[model samples]
Target: MRSCSGWRRFLLCFSLLLIIFHIFSVFEFHPNSVIEIAPKKRNKKSDHLVLGPAAGQGLPNRLQCQGSKALNKSHFLTPSNASNVGDSISFVTVFTIYSTSLDSHADDKSSNLVTVGNVSYTKKERSMAILNVFINFIEVTMPQSNVIILADPESDLSLQRNKVTLYPIQGEYNRDKLMLQRIRSYIAFLNTRLKELAQNPGHTSHYIFTDSDIAVVDDLEHIFQKFPNFHLALTFRNNREQPLNSGFIAVRGTPESILRAKIFLQDVLEVYTLKYTNASRMLGDHLALAWVIKSQPNFDLRRFSKAQAFIEEIDGASVLFLPCATYNWTPPEGAGQFRGMPLDVKVVHFKGSRKRLMLESWNFFSSASDISDMLCLILMSGRTRYDF
Candidate 1:
């Protein structure tokens, strides 16, 4: 009789487990995927950061993916067929991740290069993990776009994907030396693309340069179209001391636009390559940018409205200035000052120690096959709202 009772208890427990699994399976989570919904309602504090764009926000050209079909193979340009002689692409997103760090001594064994297959959520503090999640999210969502990585010399990420192109960033590794090298890499990469555009006048596409720590929360192909005639787009912060953040920048391929962007970058390259050395660490990139913006062929402020973006023109380059709030959502700066991810946020710059939050977000979104409504995420468990 005791043994029979034991068997009954075991069966009851198993049934309860199955019932619990059934309850949460409605969220369309991957099998064995871990989810931790809060017992309480959706935290209003964190809910400040929303997904997608809000109406009447002056974001005229937003992501319109409703009836439109994804780009066909002919339009999706890759490096393999990029030189098709008159091939045109919508835009290209570039990411730079290297084996060296701001501090170089540690990189002899450690690496920062990451790809889709090697990503793991457990290592939230790691740079590789941050970039891994970024690439994974991009590979899944941005199928219509071409992606490239200005890679470090020692990378071994053999991620066999057509959308991804790997270019080299080779040289000696050090703190100051690497900074100068990276600037040159950026110049070379952009110049090559410009050369291609010049060679084949039809080969035109805007290039969006991004830091590795940024995560794509939504589609970003429409960003270039939002601000028309912008040869260059730079996101800035409200703080005056450090006004410019080079983490995200968009450059157009027109001759005038390229000329302006080239001027700015060459000025920057000269600053790092000339001034800031390990022995004399004087001019940093941010300070250099602050100084560069004030140099010859000065950028004349055309417009500065909060609703829209601030526009500047350098001999008709049409440089557009966007706030960090709507675009690169960081913590406690622009949009970071808010509660949840805002609807206008295209990407979140996962800098400092905030990568943990990034992983949590990715897990939440990727757990579900489709999350059309934000309310679906809120009504996750028995009408209880959840937040990261």
Candidate 2:
């Protein structure tokens, strides 16, 4: 009986040990099997705690979280005890272009008459010469900030003191070729300049390209601040959906970003060279750019956000419209018949022959009447404020 009781007690002890071992095996923490826990939401005052399994020694925190709701949970899973970082630094730059001679049309021809603000001129014109005086109007109306001008190096015009930086490019007057290609060449040149800046580690976060004909009616500092991650920004041309006319562009000066752009340009050049011997067929820079962005791995072009129409503020600082009519404003055909009548416009871009003729009519009016009619038309549009 003593032997039987001792054996039974030993068996009970062994069974208990086996059960405990099984329980431990089920709950054991395996490096490979470790599951990520969902973050728990907390109040603003609560300490932001990040929870995660400790990674290898000296590894930076790599906790994956999804959605805004997850971010709101306050808990961040990090490998290390490193503090959570905030947004990265950002900056913006602008460029403009201008010409003294209204006779020297964008089409590379000389015309006798140019009109602005209701005044007309028959002889050679100066900065003061006019009819549809749009450029001068913009300079007076728009925000006075960091404005850079790309122009003919030989042209003599007294730019506002320290307000404009004069950068020159070789003028191409050829209209037979694709206008898009000429524009691309200019953009490529701008990119080269930006790449130089990118090489310096201490480069600004963003660079903006704007046509000399454009006007900034409001402050643009906030646009840069709000969307720091966007690779580019521009006013979408109504005629073409594709982002083109570098009338405006925002670029982040990084080697990777510029390299990607170079690759895109090369791809476009190669494709066009093979398909078309004429310049007109090659006039698809905007389309080509969109294609490269869509096709290339890791190249992001959807990062663009269109500027809203007529609004003064977007998120924070004053938003600037690339003056629709007066600055880069193109008047519709038959705009001249409505002479002296209020035509709504901010920036007027003389894009085609008809629009240029309309601008020429403005030169016929007296200086005072010219300013008054322009202001009245712009305000009558009801979307813009004419403080200038």
Clashing pairs in 1: 47-340, 48-339, 48-340, 49-339, 49-340, 49-341, 50-341, 50-342, 52-343, 332-336
Worst 10-residue lDDT window for candidate 1 reads 65-74
**lDDT of prediction 1:** 0.53
Provide TM-scores for the models: 0.60, 0.44
lDDT of 1 by residue, 19-80 (tens): 99987885566544433543222333231233332222223332222211111111222233
C-alpha lDDT of all candidate models, in order? 0.53, 0.38
Query: In model 2, where do residues sit more than 4 Å from their true spots?
Result: 1-111, 115-144, 151-161, 170-173, 177-188, 191-195, 198-200, 203-205, 237-246, 253-350, 353-388
lDDT of 1 at 53: 29
In the range 220-272, model 2's lDDT, one tens digit per residue, is 34444555444444343333345444345544445544444444446655555
lDDT computed for candidate 2: 0.38
Under the 3 Å rule for N, CA and C atoms, how many clashes does model 1 have? 10
Best by TM-score: 1
